[model samples]
Target: MEKRTLGTAGPRVAPIGLGCMGMSWGYAESRRDDDTSIQVIRRALDAGVDLLDTAAVYGDGHNEHLVGRAIAGRRDEAVIATKGGLVVDDLATKQMHRDGRPETLRRQVEDSLTRLGIDRIDLYYLHRVDPAVPVEERLGRPRRPRY
Candidate 1:
């Protein structure tokens, strides 16, 4: 499989990535089997698919755990992508919270690192923008809305 750079400074990864959301939880009833999911991830990597997309909010961090297990021995060969910010509870009510607060981001990133068994995440995204707080304030920087 061919490889491509994710960003100007990002690492090269296979063109295709495995979206592990289904293998973890969410989006209908959960039927995830850890062993199968891990095998699938391994197969993807063996086939040259290097990017894996997951989120902290997925399965309340269960997804990250699965990803961690799947990529245990192949960390250097894959690009891990995960998201943070959205909070969910037992009620399954997803509260879209903008937690890009620098401190929060730092903490979440650390937690994600621990869960994913990786020292650094290749990509991270804010799952949702918090309506209660201004984007600039939440992000701790100034920004202009793109038209």
Candidate 2:
């Protein structure tokens, strides 16, 4: 497959990526199936679509959990990109709020790592910039912490 990247220094990835949001949550809650979702993620990787896009508020971390299960043995083959700064307030209504404080980001990074079941995330996106927080504090240099 042809390869591209998010930026000059980002990891090389395929042009197409699979969004794992609808798999576990969102519009069709009744049709949600973990097994099928896992199969889809694996097939995407096998097909060279390494960019698996997910987010923390997508089903309130349900999407991350699904990705964690799908990439259990083949994490190296996938480029996982997940977003933070957004928290799900109501699943049914899909209401979300942004918290971009550095302290909140610190906790978010720890939580996302735990939910994704990985040591490092290929890309960590800020879902939304919290208006109450300073931009420098929320989107400054990558905060490297002991994992």
Candidate 3:
């Protein structure tokens, strides 16, 4: 239950984090048991493992909802990391599309925050890179032309 810094400026979190993706989706089938998942999450937190990684794309946002419920009372003790940029077709179909446009990123983050019931995400990562758009454009930053 040792704490470690995620990055130079990032917050310190437990060394082990719960990856909630598999709990809700992936592995060729969904095994979403909110009750069990919540227990596991609570135990992890009680054991001092505070980092929880999830994504809006997982189970088409169901995973985030579950995690939100699990961490409701102990939000201050956890570090939540969720990804954006990939949109799922539906909760059942699980089809995906990448959209890293700056506007989309901003919108997705806002939506994710609402779904997760958190004011701010401790860590946010782009789920996939969109090749059609430049990284600078996707980040809403001006691109310095290469010489």
Against the true structure, what is each candidate's TM-score? Answer: 0.83, 0.92, 0.89
Which sections of candidate 1 miss by over 4 Å? Answer: 91-96, 133-147
lDDT of 2 at 60: 84
Candidate 1 residues 15-117, lDDT tens each? Answer: 7789998886666534658898899999998888989999887777889999999999888888889987776656265444456666776677888999998
- The sequence of per-residue lDDT tens digits that candidate 2 reaches over residues 27-49 is 68888888988999999999999
Query: What do the candidate models score in CA lDDT, each in turn?
Result: 0.79, 0.86, 0.85
**How well is each residue in 1-147 modelled by candidate 3, as lDDT tens digits?**
677887665788877788989888886454557898899999999999899999989988888998999999899988999998898877677788898888888988998899889898888888999887798888875434211
Please give the ranking of all candidate structures by TM-score, highest first, separated by commas: 2, 3, 1
What does candidate 3 score on TM?
Answer: 0.89
Candidate 2 worst ten-residue window by lDDT? 138-147
Choose the strongest candidate by lDDT. Answer: 2
Off by over 4 Å in 2: 143-147
